[model samples]
Target: MHASAHVDTFARDHLPPPGQWPGLHFDLPELRYPARLNAAAELLGGGVPERPVFRTPAGPPWTYGELRARVDRLAHVLTGELGVVPGNRVLLRGPTTPWLAACWLAVLKAGAIAVTVLAQQRPRELRTMCAIARVGHALCDVRSVGDLAGAGIPGLRIAVYGGDAPDDLLNRRADAGPFPAVDTAADDVALIAFTSGTTGRPKGCLHFHQDVLAIADTFSRHVLAPRADDVFAGSPPLGFTFGLGGLLVFPMRAGASALLLEQAGPRQLLAAIAAHRVSVLFNAPTAYRAMLGGLDGHDVSSLRRCVSAGENLPEATWRAWHERTGLRLINGIGATELLHVFLSAADERIRPGTTGVPVPGWRARVQDGNGDPVPDGRPGLLAVRGPVGCRYLADPRQREYVRDGWNVTGDTYVRETDGYFRYVARADDMIVSAGYNIAGPEVEDALLRHPDVVEAAVVGRPDEARGRVVVAFAVLRPGARPDAEALRAFLTAELAPYKCPREILFLDALPRTATGKLQRFLLRARGDTGVDTDGDQQ
Candidate 1:
């Protein structure tokens, strides 16, 4: 391995051991990039002059030329005023706003690695991220400034944005002449995106300058196929990699514009789509299901593509959306480690229930525990390798993520003879009962088919006779109340008796992370306690 030519080698030095890294293969010509590359320049500089790039509800749209000028001024402020040298880590904390996007680009433009943190994060999570990334400077939203300051990270210099502070990002040096984009190696660390840490501590997933463009080139260009006049909108916060690529990189790569929404719930997202005539949407399956309830009032005719990731999309959700809107829902499975979508189906090739085949530049297969490929039609662990893979920031878990040069995504899937991948469940979400292995998601999907069930989650609980029995937690639609016996009968008719939940617990709402991911671990904890609050025990 060659030494990095970066000014600050903190990120490079802290990377996991070389032997733990998954083998990277960039066989595609489009995947190959120059040794020296700047992601900010590659993403934003190629936009058509005077074309709209970003738009919001409150303010006028920002054209490419105007955005470039702001990026240059911020780059100057980062390097000149904040003393951000090459490879230094700069933390960005904010909701999905135009200024936050600009700040992310400015960090890369100034040759610093951008560390994105979610706005909903508390002081403890903030301190952990700052400590892990060794963040030197921060550009935070005004509302989060007090919390960040209270975190008390050592030697962290903070600059507030969207406020009256003198050093606010909006009031920064606007007259600074165009600052040249930093010339950094293609493999240089450009962004350190922290994982959602649902299991434990958040780990930083390091992405290179070229890796940023590879996602847009592969998934966005080949799958979503955005047009120059298209408008992209979604609910994901910019802190998540799914949001970063869908809202910023993909749109910019195609010379399209993005609608930035600070708070995008089901109603807000639908309203924005109609108001802006958005053509592309990126959100979770849960959101798509929520959006279906009020589709009669909103005109979403302009929506040409709908991409769902961050979780497996149930067949019921996919069919419901398509039935309502007459638009095929694109289903994909991506990981923070891999940067963006590696497995997906788009356009006419999409299969409603499946996650589809690997993207053009990637290879995916179902593998046994021994890292050997499993026969088609057999459920096994999902492994993928491509131009992009996991590169953890000095964590021992890297060894678990990369095995035999393939990135082992902790998912179970079945590879059909037709070459499509059908998701079974997360590797840990499999339930073993009475010598029969069952995927909890399968039962959950069956429950979702019931009209009264708004959401469902299934897990296995210890049972003396069966070893483990299937248990379900459900949220019902307003004014709809189905008791445990009725739901049990429904599941028994839809699935095998062994797969039917022995107990059904109804809750007002299911616990979810900020990104709309179901917190199954919390549900599992509830199951372990054998407590039924709704008194639906059978």
Candidate 2:
């Protein structure tokens, strides 16, 4: 490994041991990065200084040169005034905006690890992540600072943007000249992304400077083939890796521009596509389904490429979208541990229901419980290895995720004779609702906090509107009424709105195994019923 430029080595010291790390591959030429590299510098330098980089509906596009200047200034504030050193963890919380993207780049340029979380995350969730990551500084939007401040993290210094405070991030200027990028090692930690797991604890995935560029080179370059003239737009928040790549990293890496929207629902996304003439789009299957009905009044002729992920894209949704827009959706399966899409197909190579073969520089196969490869057409766990692989931050679960140098994603699939992989179901208990991965246990914990609830279990139920909706089954205290609306309202105060259960049912007793363990499968079976508690078909 190259000598690190980090003065604080907390991130490096906490990385999973070499034996627990998944084997990394860099067979492609473009995947080879120099020993000393700064991802922000490479990304910024790859773009034409005069070309637009970020755009919004209410404002003019910010050119690459303008973005670089802003990033440099932010880096100066982080390193000079904030007294941050390399390897310090900086938590970023804000809506999707150009300034939030700039803050991400500035953190990398200054050689600090960025812990970017969703602005909608509750104080409890934020507190858990901050404690696990040892985050000391925060760059938050003024509108979203309440939650982070209420988290009450010890010694966390917050600098708000878009506010009238004298120390607002945008108001702090260090110098007029460019700030030199830190000479960091290629393997130096750049970001710590926290992902929800079945255990209800967030797993922090450690990524390096080179790992950031590797995704752009492998998937975005070889498969997506984005051009400099392409205008990108997406519905995901910047905190999600899907949005991080599609909205910021991939576009800037290709010298293209992106439309960053603070509110990108189906309606807002359709309007942005018509107003900005977006050619490349990224969204979940649920959003695509929602937009299909609204496409008649919008002009989407500028759309050339649309990528679907976060959940399996049903063949029906794919067909309906292709029939309407004459555009084939690029269906992909990726995990937060892998950073970006490693298994995907685009253009003429795409199949209706199956996720395409492994992306360039990546290898994937279906493995049995014993880590042995399963025969074609047999369902098994999906294991993948590539230039970017799993490396948890001092977590014991790393041993469970990486087996024999392969990252075993908790997803079951079938590898067909044609080499295409078909999605089956989540091998774990994670609930994929509206493109967000919600832990069933996390929601159950929130329900259990209510005074009227005695026991609770949560699961994902199939829905025509959303790909899946969180359905909860609970046993209330004796003589307490079954008030689903009241329970939902109480939960809303404890968890994010998305994580709250959409349907709640009262039960006298919960199913359990003979060994006294909760039988979640029975709860899932209950959720799969076609009729609701009132005998109305769902």
Candidate 3:
């Protein structure tokens, strides 16, 4: 496939003209702004102090009017007392709390970009991010003990928000002089979120101020479609875009209540949903799979919409979930480079094995080695373009990610004529065994279909003769563990011999990012990669 092929694949006949379906397509109306503050100000109508914006089971909910006061006070503290200068990088570390939301808005209101990090990140990772972003200030909650202490976080100044607001801190008077919103250009870097690549080191993805709202417009407007009366909940760390957008931004943007929890495991998520009447669930497929047991026992009638991402939605996982809950999962693909999901589909349009069409406002095409678009149902590298285009900040990785004005993500995909894109595998995860180029995810998807398997990941181990051999790691469902021979025979019966894993390694769990993606690089990083020394495969 060549670039010309991409042009042909998405020609006028294949898609409506650009911006053809106004409300259904291009979502510039909700997010068309230079800074993100406009989203709140516009929602509030600037008359009645913005309505209440936050809700939680642990404490009283805060309204939009009250939320604004926090952002204003924090912004004043950032500039007047804390000295967070324009364009400064202020690293924010905290759980999913109102304080966290305020910190995010405050940093932007004060003319600084908030650099968020996973509270679970080790010391070395924090140092790397601080150095790359040139962090000037840090706002963290001291409550998190142990490894999340920010031991290696280097900042010119540090402010602790949770313990208490200091008396000396700048708190705005009701009539304090015009604390006008900071002037921000559409191109200004609003955030620098890091996503771990196939290579372990996390890559910082730059997002503009305008992007803050584009995600809600695209995610909430087209995908989630949450009404003002809807209640929201998700299982992503606040630092992760998947979590931040779904739990915080998306609901608030629509004047809905977003349930926040310090922890959101399978049990916690289901409980929260039932308790708060949470109407939407935004989490990974793995979380959904894990909750199947509780779904059978819990009252989840409140959950109507579920969004699965961060990893491919296994066919079996989807079937089992839908079979148990009687609700189809809305599967989508999102990356840090694109800010939010550029390709997604509503549940009604979801195809079992494929990630549905390129989102309304976005254009996606699969290209071959020559960067030409591949025909429908054919596999190729995936590229996408939309209103929220790729613009990295001082990084050479951009050259490889963006070519011909289309952002070439690291994944492989296929398009079908009915308007859906299928996942092949990550370009880095594709293994070449003998003469065949095999996709690890495709094999893993097959393995997951087996009733005994709970989670699975496939990678290639180097071989002197075959060039590479397929290696799979699987986690079994709670009780029934089949013996090695039976499992091997089971796999052989299910898939083609060439696509089957040469060896299987069973484990309690697979290595995953905070967002719930299988980290294949870690599996390949193990010494004697094919050995499976744990001997848990059986």
Candidate that would win on lDDT: 1
TM-score-wise, the better of 1 and 3 is: 1
Best by TM-score: 1
On the 0 to 100 scale, the lDDT of residue 311 in model 1 is 90
Runs of candidate 3 with Cα error greater than 4 angstroms are: 1-52, 145-155, 164-178, 198-200, 530-538
TM-score of 2: 0.83
lDDT of 2 by residue, 243-276 (tens): 8889999999999999999999889999999999
Q: Which candidate, 2 or 3, has the higher lDDT? A: 2
lDDT of 2: 0.87
Give the per-residue Cα lDDT of candidate 2 at 444.
Answer: 71
Ranked by TM-score from best down, the candidates are 1, 3, 2
Q: What's the TM-score of each model vs. the native?
A: 0.98, 0.83, 0.88
Q: Deviation in angstroms for 157 in model 2?
A: 0.4
